[model samples]
Target: MAVALLVALTAWAFIFYVNMIDEVHDSIDDGLDNSKLLIIHQANLDSTVLAKQSFDEGNYAIRKIEGHHALNHYDVYKDTLMYMENEDDLEPVRLLTTVFEASENEFYQLKVISSMVEEDDLIEDLFYSLLWLYLILIVTILAINTVVLRSMWKPFFKFLNHLSEFKLGKNEQVQLLKSNVAEFKLLNKVIADVLESNIRSFHNQKQLIENASHELQTPLAIALNKLQLLAENPELSEEVVNEVFQTIETLQRLTRLNKSLLLLSKIENKQFLNEETIDFNDLIKSLLLDFKELIEFKELEVIFKKEDDLKVKMNPELARILITNLIKNAIRHNFNKGKIELLITNSSFQISNSGSDKELDSTKVFQRFQKESTDQSSTGLGLAIAKSIVDISGYRIEYAYSNSMHQFTVKFD
Candidate 1:
């Protein structure tokens, strides 16, 4: 802006300076015309003296010439350079020439000279004055724009800073001041609406999880307890006892599947907000110990390796469920006397088990109910639950199969 304005002002100043100089010359020429008339009158009255006089100090001169030269004469004015006794360099002057007739009828050419040094000085002064004015105006406008524009945008900058750091999961509600500016007012209203809708959705999901835990799981628990008591009856036959046990197992499986689905929903909805410091190494050892009976029944080779304790800040319940699912999936998919391996390090946890030689699809493996094994006892939701926990806890899980071995790796950072 400054450069463009300066350029425009400079061009205008140059044109104005030129016009002013031309106006000055025009005024000088008018004076010269008046002098021309007076000289003609003086020559008519005192021709000999007027013709004999030399030009000096804005004066006139009459030079005698042939009649043919007088016929060819025309009035003309021009600027010329001439050396003067008072100045070392050649000085500029304006010259006017025209043919005239004296009292004796003799032809002569009248020439007029006018000094232009003062006109040049005047133009220089005008240019400097205009340039100074342009500079002063430019500086003043810039200072005004900086102060005024910054003050006007202060409210907007404040709103932007708060909005960028806004957290939806936090207990605190978003608060924004109403703005007088139309655009800013619109922005604030739109943001408020979106945040309100998100809060509403979060509350709805929380209510659903709470209801399922209370209303559904409670009745299922009672039924399982009743089934257990019925199975313990002394009068029951062997077949009756077996049937009772099968019914209890089916109820238990149903209960677990319901619980897993509810847990997946809760994790996705961000319901487990509490966090605590837990040692993953200790957790893994305890899970392995819990499943020792299953490993023994299958005559599986269990290998465990870990470097040191891995401490992480997370929801203890969710972490336990995540690791439990991984271990359970490895066990359910393995063959009798299968080789099971657990490798734990500071950065990662890996679990591998002996299975079929064919590889499972990696894309479908993490999805719910996705499977390659035909095991009847497997729920197929184990990997999905593990994946949900991994996502919510901000960890990564990967799966691979090679050399008739299925492997699942969990990375914790």
Candidate 2:
């Protein structure tokens, strides 16, 4: 917009300058004609043939000739030499003339020529002055506009700073100070609404998890105790014992599934605040040890590799749960005598396991209730819990399958 205004102003200045030059030329022509008339009247050259010689030599033209007491044959001297010659677009030289009889058989011809070159020079100077004046004005206006725009956007920067400091689910409320601009006020209102809705949803989900966990705990405990007593009966037949063990396994799977679901819900709600510096290599080694029995039971070759002592600040319980689930899934989904490779680096950890070449949709792998294999004991909450933990920790989790290998990678800052 500023550039456009400047262009228009410049064009107007050019046109005005040209008109000024034309007016100056016309004034100069008129002044010259008046001076010629004054010289003829003062010197008394009326009715003299010598005046004709002087006029011809002066480059003035005779426009008309008039007789005494007659309107015709008026000998008029018109100065055409001083008219503008270089400008082709201007009209050709023109002057008005008339013969006046001073006495009987005596007459003086008067001519008027427009000559205003001095005025043209003044107009030229004015044009340059106005051009420079407008240039300075435009520069000043631009500088002022930049400063004003920066001041108007100050509230937006403040709002961004406040948002940057916000922590999801942890902050109970977001307050934005009022701004002078209506657009900024509207933006703040929208952000506040979204934050409020998210906080409400988080608290509601947390309450549901708490209630469900508490209500189911007593019944699950009683059932487990009754099953334990039944399995210990002395008179139980072999088939009855086998059947009881299967029922017990099914009950245990349900209990684990419930616990995993509750843990995932809590992680999503950001319920825990126990954050400490944890050694990543140590955490992986400990989790692998817990899964040693499962690895042996599946007849899988488990290899753990790492760089020593990669430390990060996170909740220890969440970290343990994440790694345990990942390793458990790897062991459960592997083929007999398959290899499970756990590799830990400074910024990331990878778990790759031997599996079938059948492709799994990696995009949906982290979604809850998504399972890659049909293991009866597998809860399908393992990867989902890992994903939630990674999100809360500001880490990245990805899955890839190639060369008959399923790989899970967790990247940390």
Candidate 3:
């Protein structure tokens, strides 16, 4: 807008300056033409006036000329410089030379001079005036627009501020502000409806997961107890005991799956809001002690190196679960006599373990029930739960495979 304004003002200033200069010249020329006529009349009335060949006292001079010199001659006006006796400096003047008849067959060349205007001074003054006008116009326009736009969008800014403060599933109500604009009013209504629907669905889904997990726990516990009793019976044959143990294992897997789903739901709902500083180095050390027997059973080479203590502020329970899941995932998918590497730094915790030579699907690695290995005992929710915990805590988790090792790195905020 400023650029366009500048272009328009410049074109106008140019045209105005040209016309003003032309008007000034025209006014000066008119005065000179009137003076020429008066001087010719005086030369005819007084012969001494025509005898003067140069201007000595007045601004006019008349000289006698031959008839041929006056032939085909036209009146001419031009600019010239003349020395001022009083100021002792050259001053600009206008000259009008014309041939006029003092008597019959007697021609006189009349030269009339007048003070000329200083065009350089005029141009400078005009440029300054136009510059000030441009600046004043820009400032006035910006001031008016600032006030107008602020008032115009007041309701929109208010609506956005209110919307930003809303949280879903917290039972907090959304407060929609009134707006005069039709579009903002419609937007407010539609967004309020969508948020209400989402909150309703969230509560329903949360209730269903909690109720299902709770209802299944009692029967699963009873079934597991009965299966364990059958396996312990002395009268049972070896094949029957094996089948019962398999059934118990399957039921336990189901139980783990149920618990995992509940945990994931809680994480996504941000239920674990309690936070405290946790030292990851100590957590990893305790977890490794708890899994010592399993590590020995697989004959896995364990290497734990603590370059620095990793301290992060997060939910203690979530921190424990996040690290535990990664450890279990590493052990569960590892090959016999494989190597497990744990490296803890000030900002991150990494676990790398030897597994299948082929890389797991990175895109689906953290998805629910994405089994990448042939471990039938695996529930396949370990990595998914870990990912959910990390997301809720605003931490970062990454997976990479190199040198036949499946590596999981969790970086703390």
* Best-performing candidate as measured by TM-score: 2
Candidates in descending TM-score order:
2, 3, 1
Residues forming the 10-long window of minimal summed lDDT in candidate 3: 165-174
- Ranked by TM-score, the better of candidates 1 and 2 is 2
Clashes per candidate, residues 3 or more apart or on different chains: 0, 15, 0
lDDT of 2 at 324: 86
Question: How much lDDT does candidate 3 score?
Answer: 0.86
The full ranking of all candidates by lDDT, starting with the best, is: 3, 1, 2
Cα error of candidate 3 at position 283, Å:
2.5
Question: How far does residue 281 in candidate 1 sit from its true spot (Å)?
Answer: 3.9
Tens-digit lDDT track of model 1 for 1-413: 65676687768767877788789889778777888888888778775645454565536777888888888888898888866767877898888888887745678888877788887687678778877886787778778877876777787788777777664465546557556778878888888898889888888888888898889899989999998999899999999999989988888888887887888898888777778987889999999899999989988999999876678788999989988998888888888989999888887888999977788889999998887777655667889989988888889999898778889998888
What's the TM-score of every candidate structure? 0.62, 0.69, 0.68
User: Which is the leading candidate under lDDT?
Assistant: 3
Alpha-carbon local distance difference test for all models = 0.82, 0.75, 0.86
Model 2: per-residue Cα lDDT over 1-413, one tens digit each:
77887788778877877777676655665665666666456435544532453232443333223464346654343434443445434433335465655456655555544433444456668878988887897888788877897788776787788788776656666668577788887887888889888878877887899899988876887888898899999899989989988998888888888988899878877886668998978788877788778788889998888874578889999888888888888888889899998888888888999977776788898999898788878888999999999999889999998678899999886
Cα deviation of 212, candidate 2, in Å: 2.0
